[model samples]
Target: MIKKFVFTISIPIVLFGCSVTTTPNGKQVDMLPLISDKNRYLIVDDKNLSKAEKLENYSNQLSEFYGKQNSAYIRVLPRPSYQTNDRFTPIPFMVYEIDSNPVKIFENTMFNPNNVRITEYAQHDLRIPIGKHDLIIVNGLGNSRWFTKIDDVNFEKDKKYVIGADVKKGQNAQIFIAEYEIDNRFKVVEPEHFIIKKKIIENIPIGNLKSVKVY
Candidate 1:
């Protein structure tokens, strides 16, 4: 079973000095492009660009990278749509670790239903190496902070997957990790439901930390 916990503590800023490399197969580059400008995968955060324009840029970029047969595309949609009561508020989340390695320091963007291109936001598509990876996700709900893990995910190359959540008032959030078949345009056209693997819900915690270092 996937375990979860919540704690109220100040998040500390910790510097992680490590080298992240990208190969021609689009492994590390697609996963953490924000680590450096040399990685062409970095999204150009032009505030002047309309939401549609930003999405178009991402679409075009994804289409161009479709030939990378060694990499898999994954998008995390914790707040896929507007909530009934919290329409404008952000559901902050962070991918703290991947395959036992600490994710390099990065900024988390507010959930914007309009801007579809992958930002540090919860709804962006990320390219990652094809293999079994253990992931840790930290998310916020109201005044509490919680975390969960997706372990032993065997991602295949050239496939697209979406990890989304179903949250309700006075209920624990249910998360689904679904795989999809993409078209020539790199858009998710059909849902391969059988490809989905794990399903879990949030749980309450019994302890708190003075401070947490997520980076």
Candidate 2:
């Protein structure tokens, strides 16, 4: 009888000892409220999101958090075709400064949360032309799923903006929204719409060199 009791008690302890994985299937990503760090800025225009299902199978709460056809979580379900020929691992977000020589803002991609990158890069303020620029998102499998050219984007100093991706038609395309506001010093500015972690905002660097030019 004592042996039976001991065996039953041990089961619970063994289960508790197991490590919990924060990432789902090694491909899920927790969406950030401000895709860019506080110092860097970009605003996504308001648009009717192309309604379709994407992350429903993964998380219902996260799907509702986005308030549309997107999720607070993203799963990178990469296909073999996308990895063909050893392509640079597909990043879900990319920005290019429009100029005589368009420069890819690699640092921004490095700093943002991604499934492919192991550790995030040290983030700093972005210095772009502050005019028209191309913001692109390629999901898992290296597919260019969303691309838009936004004009007159205001990336002024000392302000933070919230960017969210709207994946539609089963992840065929995406429309991102950027809502602008004054920096609140790590406070949640728009909780009614979404909640952003204070830690993520403060991690933004108030620095020189502007690692990401928000062109």
**In candidate 2, which residue pairs get closer than 3 Å at backbone N, Cα or C atoms, i.e. clash?**
44-178, 127-213
lDDT of 2 by residue, 1-215 (tens): 99999999999776544422133224221122213332122212422211111111112322222234411222222222333235554333333222212222222233333212211110111233332333322223232222233333444333334433444564433334343333445433222323332211111111111112111
| Runs of candidate 1 exceeding 4 Å displacement | 1-69, 78-88, 92-94, 104-120, 166-171, 181-215
Worst 10 residues of 1 by lDDT: 206-215
- Candidate 1 lDDT, tens digit per residue, 124-182? 55565677877755554443434455667777777776666556798655555667443
CA-lDDT, candidates in order: 0.45, 0.29
Which candidate number has the best TM-score?
1
The lDDT of model 2 is: 0.29
In model 2, the Cα lDDT at residue 197 comes to: 28
Predicted model with the maximum lDDT: 1
lDDT of 2 at 55: 16
- Give TM per candidate: 0.43, 0.29
